[model samples]
Target: MTARNNSFDEQAVLHELKQFLPALSPGKTFTYRNPLEGFQEQTFDDALRHASEMLGYRTTLSLEEYRSLYNSKRVKPGVLEKVLVEKKGAANTFEWQDKVLMKKFPAAAESPSKIGKLRANWQKQYKTDLDARVHPRLFRILGNYLDHGVSDWKFPVRGKGFLDSMREVESNSFVSAFNTPRARNLLLQASSSINDLLTVIVGDEMLFKQYLFDQQFAHRGWSGLVATLEIGREISPNGSNITLRELIVFELLLEIDVLDDRLGRHWEPLSYRLPAPPEDLFAPVPVGEKSEVLAIWQEAVEWSYYEAILAELRQDPQNTRNQTGTRVTETTFANAVDSLCIIGQPSLLRSVTAEHRAFRHGYDFSLDPNGEMLEEILEAVVPSLGVANLECFFARTGLAGMDDILTDQMIGLLGLADTARGDLQAPLPAGLTKDFEPMRLLCVVEQFPETVLEVIDRLAVQSTCVGRRSVGRRSIALWLLNEWVHLVVIDPVSRELRVLKNRKMITYKSAPRIVIEDAVH
Candidate 1:
């Protein structure tokens, strides 16, 4: 091969190649390093795109994987909403929500690297498999050259760089890994510089750096090992000296030799077959709808966990400390008890008591106390009885002559009647019945003829008692007055009165009634 004027910066290409290689030093203790340490100065999204487009690496989980997390509730709705709001602004929350939850998008295809396309043509255009033929031998050779301590015998030329050592061994050995003599001759006679070999193989000086990147990254595991060992001597205890430049040069020589053996010595460089130079590997990756969708889901998944942590941190310090097992004081215990009473227990008890009362009242009034014969009589008389007839019946029954009383005051009398009746059966404690005046009045009212009157004059409208027969404590009477049917119930044991008008119960404290007169009107 003849030397040509350099059209590219060889040192710059080598320096950039070092940046893309694995930076982790191999030793007894494992250490971590960013694979894209080269793009450290770039934004996270930029670095991710570069790694993906140039190296064919996946930087984040798949969209479906994130969607599965959402289904499992590992990604919370509130957290996702907040994340969307932060990313897209509150105005677009609904827009983004629909996109993430309902919209469907196809997965983005992996972008092919620039140099990958160049090498792939050999298999597409011709039946030759360059990677299949070259990678195995190239990896084996690179692996032996950069062996840390795994080899039984160390490489012969320890400190002399990779190409020098490989050439020395190939020249001396009777058996060789190469298929052709041209391969051996190239290794022995070729300049150690990567640019010299690229001039022969690539021909296009502009594509030299990209070609090197493509070739090295095809076997990046071995390439990275060589690159790692080259930069960091302390990575291996034996201190192997190697450079990425030497690895690239030798790998190119192997490719050329393989092409000669497979196709012919006359085969041209990859540049001759190309329509145009390959795209820049480090160019900005284009953003599409798929990436946007993935980005939204990715942020949502991450924020799901972070939101929970932030919520806890934002809580009241005292409450947070208590939750973490702080001692409870008497005041705190009392406060908790008060809160339980106010929020949890009293309202529940009130609801249950009201329901029980309604049920009991409904059951007590479900049946007619007087029997089916009187039901037929009242049902027949109810339609014919007018307000004049009802007023006359009230007058004859003596209910119209009673003094006026407010509904609340009438209810108070019923309560007193209940107490007085209970006292008659079981003697009250001495002070509990200090005054029996209300009790005396209740007994007087119970003895009135109107309390048990059954028949009315002229109209023949007999008031019939109705109540639950199973519970014999209360007695009810049905009165037909014009269009209304009134049920007046008196507890037999307590003599307490309650009215159900038009089949609905009314609050005794609020509803006003003129006793028999209201029914007449």
Candidate 2:
């Protein structure tokens, strides 16, 4: 695969690419274009399988992963059986499903040469597994890229172009590295010579397009960067274009250039073979420290939405507070960057983002009648915060000092300040216990006031009979305050609470002050 003259038909390559690549406009005119846009002719499952074969992507879950989902009931075995029966019409679809479940699927296979060598050298030099040794920030960014769920924001690339902004991250950007005379000569040669690699990887234009689609979904950040940089080759209307096949070759050339520096290998044959490099290049930085490079990458990638929020906050000068705090100043930007750097885990970041969004929801609702500010605030907060803390997350925007109100009002309304003290417990029905944790109760009260009163009413009656009921009985007292009333609940057995509800039907919904007295006393 020696370097060829820059005489290859660029149009031919571009023409081949047009059959498969999706036309992606810049982030400014972003739309919900399907990642699988080119494969509209095939079913999702068939497209997944074909793309997996072409790009070495994981098209389906592995047996162990599927088994975990099945056991968790996320993917019910019964449902799979029924679907299989309908689709295959086999005599015993259950038997066929069981066989499919027992089989092991291969994990995505690694490519040859440069990438493989780098991974090997990394393991050999550091005595650390490359996959296990990613920097926290790098891992966080990668998690967000690969996240098929739980992430509300997807593939946010900002700036004049992907490579344009990526250059600002450090003194030496990929653009500068590849734009050098020597790098330029190599790119020209490789650009002209890409058809050879494409011929080996993709027989027809459709397969090449499918490979692009697969690669984009496989690591959208990198693919998106390539797409934006090579917009010149696009065949779409108005000079706008996306051609993933050429982008793959272009990105590979960049990787080869970088690898030439990293390993001091000419790696000229890589231009010929064009083995897929790892989706991203890392310095193989030490495993413990936060990755400043990855942080920079993430910041550049998400700068648009970040600045958009700052701009919107500037419009409303009176409101300086957001869920993440002050939005009108430089500190807000710094805090956003710091959050991106420090959050070690993606799940934790997601949790923090969710909590921050929820806080902004309540806070914005309190501040303005219109929901536009809320939407903007949420969009800004989406990038920061760890999702790891979501399991027990609560909104902390304007709810300051409310915990004290909740506790004191229950005692004041019930007139059981001396009797209940700290011993009262909320007795949940056996059927509802799984859904009735304290944080869940708080979430219900906070978000859905109309939906939670019945449950609260049941809890109130049980609080009244706690000490007198039996030797081993206990109850949980809950206090809720909405716009209308300060409601207190004592949770006990449903039957016992039902008797109280029937006994005090008169004051139940209207006068919370009297309702507490009749139900509890």
lDDT of 1 at 226: 60
Point out the worst 10-residue segment of candidate 1 by lDDT. 437-446
RMSD in angstroms, all models?
Answer: 39.7, 24.9
Report the number of the highest-lDDT candidate.
1
Model 1, total clashes:
1
lDDT per residue for candidate 2 within 226-301, as digits (tens), equals: 3533543322222223344544554444434444444454333323433443332212213211122112112222
Best by TM-score: 1
Off by over 4 Å in 2: 1-30, 56-81, 92-94, 101-181, 184-220, 225-268, 271-521
User: Which 10 residues in a row give candidate 2 its minimum summed lDDT?
Assistant: 512-521
Question: How big is the positional error of residue 190 in model 1, measured in Å on the Cα after superposition?
Answer: 5.3
| TM value for model 2 | 0.30
